[model samples]
Every structure is written in structure tokens, then in C-alpha cells.
Target: MYWHIEDSRYRIANPIQYLISKLGLSMDSLSQFVLGAAVSTAFLGRKIGPRKAALVGGVLGTLPDLDVLIPFADPIDSFVYHRGWTHSVFVHALAAPILGEGLVRLFRGLRDHRWLTWMTVFLCLSTHAVIDAMTIYGTRIFWPFYPDPVGAGSVFIIDPLYTLPLLGVVIWALFRRNWTSRLQTSVVAVLLGSSAYLGASLAVQRHVEQMALEIFSDNGGKPERVLAIAAPFNILVWKVIGLDRDSYRNLYLSLAGGNEPLEVYTHPRNPELIACLEDTPAYQKLDWFSRGFNRAELVDGRVVVSDLRMGLTPGYAFRFVVAEADGQDIRSVTPKRDLSLRRADAEDFAWLGDRLLGIPAARAAEAGFQSTTRDRAAFDCSTD
Candidate 1:
């Protein structure tokens, strides 16, 4: 029997199903809802009343994610197809006017402020895509015109620092029966604050990238690409990944701490194991989705590929069993999500606090900080 272990906690499902099954809300969705409600309330509140505008805005904000309910052929299709056409700015541009016109006709008060209504709808919709593109998970903002995903990788997916202020202002506005000048100023202030936070994150990311490049070069390592992302909920600590020909380097830096020697860990890419499967649809999709930051391994006679951008070292959020050993040859199989290597240890969260404070701990591998290596000898791909 071909049996593989799966983690039911991290299983993929349609967004609605996943929300219901987990009884939890994703930060991305919450951020979008807050942003939409805030933007609509700020611009359309005076004309259409704050409560109604916020309600409509909240619904529009979640509209783009509706693409998740669309069925795909396979797991790989489902993975890469998300945030594609629906998140596109071009699509949002076309959709805004239609939605805006409908709202104008539906609400008699909004008929006089057609242009403001359209602009508000457009900004509410496009901001969702803009914020999504800020994370490590790429978004195809341009879509059909430019199919590649764009990821700023500056901010973590769920940052309470960025979302809470905007949410507070929205709640305040909702309580008031009428939109006052004071409420309008508060809304504008929070919106600007959120934008400034994003800008600051981008600036910090550039600094980290330059630092990583210099450190890699000083160590006699020529990295092909370097990516820096905020660590979890805070921007004070950064996780940097440097991609090379045969292996990748992972390091963490705390801006709060002054200049300190970085401890870099190297992990094998095992490209040879998947050289034969490169042309397969599953491999290609993963490669494109991860922007070539993917690694392959052979485990239990199965060929697995993992996106290196998400999760921590050794474990990843998206791993797929794309191929299986068939005697001396490898055969492509339907992509099956493999969460056996996914790690979510509570100890790692403890380590994150110390690491963020600039306190050096034991070697990452020994300190239970999501640092480990996979034994390549466990499975052989000599035939490939």
C-alpha cells in the first residue's frame, strides 16, 4: 500500500471551507476587510452614511478572494492559480466602475457623487491587491499583461501593528450615526499611517538585502539571489535567504541589535534528484510560483519538491509529492500535498523572542529554532 502521512491542520481547502473548518480567520482577509471598510467609509461616508458605506466596502474587499472557490484540476493548479486574475489591477479597474455604477443606482444619495463613488470603489479594490503583494506570497497584479507574480516580501502576512490602528478607526466611525470632520481626519490619519508603515518596511527590506549581500560576499559566497523578509509579526528582526547554485543560506538579523556577526546555515538544493522531472507540469508550476526558490528531495521512494520561501528551515508550508520511484525509473504522479515535513513547534516561537532581542542562542539546529538538515543519503536518485 502507498501510504503517506498528512497533517490535517494544514490541509488546503476552499477559503470558505477552510475558515469554517478551522474556526479561524486569516490575517490577510481581516486586513482586506478593514482596509476596504476604512477606505469606503472615509470617502463615501458623508455621501452615503458611514455604516452603509463600510458594510458595502467590507463586502467588496473580500470579493477578490472569491477566486478561491473556483475549482482547479489539481493541487498544483490550485496553489499557483490563486491571486492571479482576481488580484489583477486591470481587472479591478474594470470591476470598479461597474460596481460603482450599481451602487450609485441602488443608493439614491450616491447618484450625485458618481466620480467620488467610482474612485472610492477602485481604491478599495486595488488596495487589497497592493497589500497582498507586500507579502512573501506573490500576487499577479498585472495578470494577463504580465503573468509573473510580484512580491515585495517586506512585511509578514499578519502584522498587528499595521492592521490594528486602521481597524480601531473603522470601529469608531461605525459607532457614530453621522460622519463628522473629526472622524474624517482620524480616518485619513490611520490610512496614511498604514501606508507609511508599508513604505518603511520596504526601506528596511532594502537595507537588509544590502547587508545580506555584503555578508555573503565577505564569506566568499556568491549568491545568485538574496531575499529579505520581516520575521513574523515584527519588522525589527529579518530573515534573509541567499540562493546559490547547489545550496541556499539562511540567516536572521535583528536591527534592534547593533552590528553582529551573522550565523549562516547552508542547506542542499538536491537539484540532481529532480533534473529529470524539471519538465513535468507540477515541477514547472512550483518553480514558477516560488520564483526558482525551490528545493527537491527523495523521501520514502517518492520525489518531493518544496517552496523555500514559506515556513522555516528544513520544513516548508507547501511540499508536494510530484513523482514516485518506479523500479529504476521515476514516474510523474498527481501532485499530492505533503505536510509531513511542516514544522510548527511552540519552542520556535520562544526562540523568536530571544532572537529578536539580539540575544545570541545556541546553534540554531541545537536550540530548537527550526534549524535542521535532511540527510540526502536517506534516498538515492542515482538513476536520475
Candidate 2:
């Protein structure tokens, strides 16, 4: 998965609960994953000399994310930038031999053992690519070498279970210099075990969804679509989102501990808000890019377009949010969320649809403050 470094730095000095509630994972995981890969290189490549080891480590640490700069080349290729060329095993294979040969000449001292250096470089780069392939986000590993994205679809982007064990092994290895004995075995064990655990988690989540379907069916409503997400690691809190037959009958089930299947909290879907987009060309273009994960809602007169494929929440999470199709001075949208409303709150439009059944809000809690805050008047489109 592509961890935008800019996004990680923005959430520093927060509690784990705050991180989980807002950003969905601890910020420290980002540091550990990158640093651990570098440390792993240092552990394996010391005989090749420390400078070469550090070079291999640094290159391996950064090679997977080289695709982030792809946007600078062309604006139309933003999404294509992430999980792109660098993530491919074919690119790693081609780049590693070239990098290893370059390092041998540049370092001078490692000229005699050039093959070992090349092997170390190839292994380090290849491992980074393989680690990324374990996540749900697809990576075109083989590229022109294969053209198919190798996706495990097991772990989420911010999985502590996968990160922490590997981190723990790296930390242990950092303290103990010997790489061939205990540390190597421990690192391999943790890495492979984490992958197995995530696979099991995916299987368990699928079974839980089947159980949820039966419960929803028994409760006198059939869900047209369901999205089940295991909150954090242990499947303690599973968030269940369902779109009923009418589409407006949206339901949210926060089932804790996984065993007991809850019916659902009374929530309504507002897919009709997407209908309001029929008048806008920009929205139509965005919809094409979003690939059915797009959701549009009228908030404070201007429409709020959310690409659900990104973040489930706002604030600390990163998403591609844009203003409505109204031609006005609405400026730009950023990685930060508009805290005034949420995906759940936007579902209220369905209630607004039912004039007979409606209710409603305070700015204090909404604005991340204890007291009411003034709503900054954004571009108003109704009068326009």
C-alpha cells in the first residue's frame, strides 16, 4: 500500500486511540516499516561494507514508493502513480542489477565481491516489493514481465498485526549484531506468521459476513449490498454497512467481539443525492474516475463529492474530496476532511426525503470543540 509520507507526518504526537479513531493506524508504524527494511539490509550486508549496506538499505527503503512522483509528470495520471511501476517485481529485477553494478564502481572497496553485492541488492529490493503485494491494494508486480496485479487482499493498509512483529524482530536484531543465528530466524518467523494471520483474518471476516447476511434476512430486510470491515486487529469491533432493497434503507451494525451478530442501527442511504450531479460536467468526469465508489451529497447548498474508495472517515484520514459542480470560487480540497459533516450525516438526506420522518445537530462536537463554533460560510451555490 502507498503510505504518503506527508500524510504520516501530519498525525504526530497523538494517542493510539486518537490515531485509530482518526487516521486508522499508529503513525509509528510508518517509521518502523521503513526503518526496519533499512535495518534488515544493514543486518544482511555488513560484509559488503557499511556504506554499501546503508546504500542498499536506503534504496530498498525508498524504491517501492518511487511511483509517488509520477503525478509530477502528468496530472491525468495521479491514481496511476500509486501502486505503479516501482511496485512491480519486474522493475525491481531490472533496477537491482543496474544498482548493484553502479554501487560496485562507486564504492570501490566492494569491487571484488560484486556478485554478493548484486545478490544482496536484488534480495533487499525484491523483499520490499513482496511485502507490499500482501495488502488489499493491488500491485502490478510483474508489469510488462506479467501485466497482472498480484494482490493477496489479506491485510489492510494500517495493520498493526503485520507491522509490530516485524518491528519487534528488527529492534531485537539492532541490539544484537549477529545476523545468521537467532535474529534471522525470528525475522523470518514474524514476517511469515503475520502473513498467515492476515489470511486467517480475511477468512474469519468472510464467515462473519455470511452470518450477518442470515441475521439481516431473518430480521425482515434483505441487504442489496454489504461491506464488512474488521476494526483494528482482533475483529473485536466489526463495522457492517448495508444497502437495502430500496437503497435508502441504509443500516450500520457495530458488532463487538464478532460472535454476537447485531441487527443494525437505524440509518438511511442517500444514493439519490448522486442524482443532483446530473447537472455538472466535473462531477461526471470524477464519477468516471471513481468507478462507482463515488458518492455525492448536498451540504450547505454546495455538493460534497466523496470518493469512498479512499478513507472511511475524515479528519486524520486521507481522501480525494472535491467541491460540487457549481461554477464558483470554491478553491480546492485537500487531504484533510471537512469536519462539519460525515458520511453518516450525509445519509440524513434520505430522512429529508421522508418529510414525515425527520430530525437533526450541534457545532460544538461537530467542530472538534467543547463549545459551538461559527460555520465559515463557503461558496453558496443556491443563489447563483
lDDT digits (tens) for residues 303-352 of candidate 1 = 89988887787667678889887655677788888766534455677678
Q: What is the lDDT of residue 180 in candidate 2?
A: 50
Which is the leading candidate under TM-score?
Answer: 1
Highest lDDT model number: 1
Give candidate 1 misplaced runs (Cα > 4 Å). 1-25, 258-261, 326-328, 362-384
lDDT of 2 by residue, 1-384 (tens): 434433343345334423444454333235334443545444543454333354456556556676665544322235433566776766777777788788778766568877876776666666666655654345677777675555443445566666676556555654553345454566567756865876776786676667667767765476776555553333433444455422312222333322332324433223444444434544454455443444544456444655443434332132334444354334333223333433333333342222212222111212231211222243333212
**RMSD of each candidate relative to the true structure:** 4.8, 9.7
At residue 286, candidate 1 shows an lDDT of: 92
Look at candidate 1 and tell me the lDDT of residue 186: 88
Residue 275, candidate 2: alpha-carbon lDDT: 46
Candidates' C-alpha lDDT: 0.79, 0.48
